[model samples]
Target: MYKNIKVIAFDADDTLWVNETYFRDAEHQFAKLLSQYETENKIDQELFKKEIENLKLYGYGIKGFILSMIECALELSNYNINQKIISKILDIGKEMLEKPIELLPEIDDVLEGLQHRYKLIVATKGDLLDQERKLEKSNLLHYFHHIEVMSDKKPTDYLKLIQHLDINPSEFLMIGNSLKSDILPLLEIGASAIHVPFHTTWAHEKISEKEQEAADYRTVSNIKEVMGLF
Candidate 1:
């Protein structure tokens, strides 16, 4: 269906590899640290919800997430936080930075198949160091002709990337997990998008109702389905 697409841009995190799994695991460990102060029912689930809500206001990234965990810890512990508990939370944040990058099943094959026919670019939003490290570790770094690591995925960012790659927006295709960050803005710019939903998306990346209704967007269950576009 997308054979005319000359440039195919992919979102790195949950789209090409396993990212949400790390965040979910870290959150579970974080909840465990708070279990002693407040009852499991009150502290874990409520705090997890608070953190998710905070993500919309503060946005995603280790810094904001760590801060939310710290706030939750302090609140639950009644300002008498244990040093070891604090250390463990910080360690969880560090572990995310050091987590191994494992690409989704069939991602490599799909990219390899399309590389010959179209220009591939990776457009991901996150800390630059983290994103770069992931691309390097995944061994899929060489597949993309361009890499855009940004703090946000606004329409301007998409336009800039398309311009930088010298491709018209209509001729480019974006495949990603987040409808908010990946699909909507690109679609607003007249680009095509394929949505590959992740089971545990960060709260901030969730799509709004209005953005969900716009443009040439297609949804797939897995990354491999993206190959059908070629």
Candidate 2:
């Protein structure tokens, strides 16, 4: 099936290593800290709203998430949030940033099996520095031919990458956890995609079942299933 595929792109966050789990944990901590002012449900909703609002300016990654948490805390608390609580929020962000990379099962084996046979690259959206740091820490950097820290994952972005790599959409394959960011965009551009879902997903990345049904992509149980495709 992959006989024609020249470039195999992988997403770096939940697809490659632990990401949203930390974010989810942080959200819980944030809600607990602010629970005195509002219900946990309301705090979660407000934080999500703030995250969506800040997406344009902050994009995606730990730093933006931290800022949104701070803003949500202030707004939820009527700007009367305690300074110590703010410190704790920052600490949560720090811990997230410093968390070790927990690569998915058989990621190394899959990469090892394919690295010599195909052009492997990371096509992920996040803070460039943070992604690079994680890649370095994973000790898997040597397996990939390139790394792309995309501002957004739209058809146009994949088109640009295809052009840059001098490959046709039909010759490229994308694999990731988000249907919205990683799968649908590539499929729309005529590239093949594989959806390997992480257990947890961010609210914004969630897609309707109808959308998933309509998209032409393969779905797999884990990263190791990628090896079977070849």
Can you give the TM-score per candidate against the true fold?
0.87, 0.98
lDDT of 2 by residue, 1-230 (tens): 66899999999998988889988888899899998999999999999999999999999999999999999999988999999999999999999999999998889899999999999999999899998999999999999999999999999999999999999999999999999999999888888999999999999999999997887888999999888878
The alpha-carbon lDDT assigned to residue 37 of candidate 1 equals 81
Query: Local error of candidate 1 at 33, Å?
Result: 0.5
The segments of candidate 2 whose C-alpha lies over 4 angstroms from its true place after superposition are none
Model 1: lowest-lDDT 10 consecutive positions: 55-64
What residue pairs clash in candidate 2, if any at all?
Answer: none
Q: Write the per-residue lDDT of candidate 1 for residues 107-198, one digit (tens) a residue.
A: 98999998998889998877677788889999998899889887678999889888888879989898998988888888789889889998
Q: What C-alpha lDDT values do all the predictions have?
A: 0.83, 0.92
Q: What's every prediction's RMSD, in angstroms?
A: 2.7, 0.8
Best by TM-score: 2
Off by over 4 Å in 1: 1-3, 39-59, 208-216
Lowest lDDT 10-mer window, candidate 2? 211-220
In candidate 2 the C-alpha lDDT for residue 192 amounts to: 91
